[model samples]
Target: MNIGLFFVPFFEVMRMLFAYTTEKQLVNARNATTGTQYYCPDCGSLLIRKAGSLLIPHFAHSAKEICHGMSEGETIEHLNLKQMFYQWGQQTDQQWQLETPLNDLAQRPDLLNRKLAVEIQCSSLKSTRLAERIKGYSQNGYQDWWLLGVKLRPNKKFTSLQKQFCSFSKDKGVHVWGIKKDEISLFYHIYQQDQHYQYSKKIWPSYSVPITTILNTNLSELPPKIILSKQSVLAEKRRLAKRLSCSEPKVMKVQTYLYLQRRHLLYLSEWIYFPSRYSFFYQEDLLIFRLLFQQEAKNADTIFKKFLYYRETMQRKWIFHRIEEREILERLYLEAIFCQRKAKIL
Candidate 1:
């Protein structure tokens, strides 16, 4: 027997079997409910049980309800927009209010910062109404409003109207105004149905920002922040010595370590490392690592161990000496990898 093929089917069968077991467990858990029967935790709606061969208990409302009817695929897109707004607010030293009411129009943006109103429009709306709603933001005191339209097969006319809206906002006093389209299909296909906003993050320039600015940031200023930590700098130098077949480290301490200790050194490193990982091959693995380490590290040690396994791979020989070094160096390498990955993925 071909072992590889057998293992392939074995894994597939195991996956399906696990899924089946899980679904059975869920059904049993749901049927044995201690309390309410029809309510969904997601949107606080009365759910009607959906029958299917899948065995998992699926529920739907009699009528479509906002947020309640969102497919499993869309949940992450919504969560990602929420998370991005949150991260942007933190980095920019701004506050993001969720579900905050706007002017008397009762329009509540998904996220509202001091200068910008961000709406995560996952559903289609009339083009005229959409334009009017955004124009209303300009009419109000919001100087920079962004409508992130998450749609499946966005209408060309809608895209054109969005461009017109940006132009119109420029004519007005608004400093920044734009519509970002996050294609649901792209998210589905590219991310392999993973629930985070990887697709949106990858194609963000298409919808959120300009491509040139993204490239410039990647090329000019996204490196040093990612790969060369204080310990990793020394490790890298040591690695170079072995590669050059010399006793002395090719890159001096002044070149590698002196600047590495500076308070703003990571920012410089970002500029150096960002360009290399822009290729397609490194992009996915890099992104997966970043998603794993986000918000888990307050200091260098915590960040490094997160993706230490990848460091062990011989493929990264171009970067470091033996992967098994001091814990501190290992940690630094992981952090650098994360930074490089995040810049590309985000």
Candidate 2:
């Protein structure tokens, strides 16, 4: 198996023979044989009975090894969440399948129904795994939704890469789900405005009704814009500023640019502090753009064309094809703001 395959997380654990078997059927079989009890679904290895207070009673492999269709390991939290999802799916109003494997794509979705497929994402994941899941579901004609665990591994603020490639739906729009304590929050109707992705984090508590309450949720009531609290914005900007100040060489270069432009290093606008995504790199470039914007806020068309002219000559080194797309987007955002400022002045 690819070491990469071992690292790729299952949306949930594998199905067992027990799922299809009745207790009476298991009671009639003898436990003396390797085939009598649980076995690894992927490799057919004999599994051990592991029951303890700290963990839910589940079968484990007799030896330490990786199996293709099995989970890396299901934590107590993982088991509980899976049970919640399965129980929720057992509602009378809908037909659902849990840990249903897609043989064609070789992937198992966490929960599947006619309208939706959900992944109980509880850990930091790799891009390859996410991409594979997205492509697999898309090709197979299933809409994938991700539910992130806020109660998971401490210290997960919003992620940039995940933000870049999240699952989308026509009815719900783009969304990011959060499981905080017992209540679940949905950040939907998302869009990137001025480079940063934003969405409404609307909370929906766990209810006793069918899962449709959450699944077929009506988001028309939520705000169109994701409004971050003033404190959060300022705090994030401060944290970013502190991080940027640590690199001595980068700081010196930015300071040199500020000095040349007769601008103060420590006194740039608060807007300058927010990064394009989580990063506002290319220190010299940012400083140049900041000074230019401040100088020509009332004249967008001229300054943007001048910046394009400058990019073709003096900044040819920064014109690497890999980065040009983002650079162009940022320049266009600056131009929009500049035009707004010009309109206000007129």
Candidate 3:
């Protein structure tokens, strides 16, 4: 089994379990003879195969130039998780490859099986790079699965960067994967309640659940939907009112905008406060956007078109990679219309 590379203490260098010999034949460090010369598959430089009772068999770069294909470094947790995945694949007799390089895409996924490319993210990454890598995989006919490392796990809210990893599915809604020790956590049914976001979590022992089963979870296995209680909405409304009374800079800005449109901040359309999980990704202020939609849209028939217009004219920032912009906007519009009608009845 190929273990790829892991951070080694000696000389503070990464030692890969796979290498190539002078004949250009790939060799696993466990099988390669110590006296035989091995070369880095990526850099094509001489490699020193290290083996001992204290250390796992691996090959380290003979020189200082690190492989450009990998990240600057891998955390111990990251490497261990990768190893665990490899072991699980072996146990299940699945054809999984580690650090498979997609030469055409110029990207190397942590693990690959057919069209599925799994990326393990253990540390903070620039959003632009994340977007670029995702696009690259998608364009090259591969599905990218990002599993967040322990440090990148969401708490109260997902950071803008973490939001980039989220993918939408009809069954799971907006969801992301995180590694919690030896368990895999699925944070699904993520929805915005009021000013805060909530999600239902499911956990499975790393080897207990098959990777395919997790990836192919369908509506039949859907988690229960999150309910936004009236009390939460009321509390959020009170918070908004308090902020306005205190003249908070951000809240005052929204008030000024509403004033220009001849709309009272305290008496905006009820849809402006409707909860939506998808709309949380919108760059524009959610309440302001809802108010504008309520004002400009004639009825439900025109809501979607009007939203597309606003999205184009205002140039909203799109961060969710897998979810379509129209899908999110349309869902928000319908949810708003429903909320508006519900308000009228109450």
Error of 2 at 174 (Å): 6.5
| TM-score for each model | 0.29, 0.56, 0.81
RMSD of each: 22.4, 9.3, 5.2
Please rank every candidate by TM-score, starting with the best.
3, 2, 1
Give the best candidate by TM-score. Answer: 3
Give RMSD (Å) of candidate 3 vs. truth: 5.2
Across 1-346, the per-residue lDDT of candidate 3 in tens digits comes to: 4333342343435556677789977776778975788887676778787777755666676446577654345555666677777777667657888765566877778788888898888877777777888889989999888899888988898788778888887888888999855888888877665557778888878788678787786755564444445664576678789988898876776677678778777786554565555545762256765775677664644665655554565555677876787777677776666666766765
Q: Mind giving the per-residue lDDT tens digits that candidate 2 earns over 223-309? A: 353333344446645644664578555555556656776876667665444333212223335534544666785365656565555
TM-score of 2: 0.56
Candidate 1 per-residue C-alpha lDDT over 180-275 given as tens digits, one digit per residue, 9 for 90 to 100: 433211111111111121122224433344322322232121222123344543443344445435433322321243244442212333312232
Q: How far does residue 36 in candidate 3 sit from its true spot (Å)? A: 3.9
Question: Which 10 consecutive positions of candidate 1 have the poorest summed lDDT?
Answer: 13-22
TM-score (C-alpha) between model 1 and the true structure: 0.29
**Any runs in candidate 1 off by more than 4 Å, and if so which?**
1-75, 121-123, 147-161, 168-346
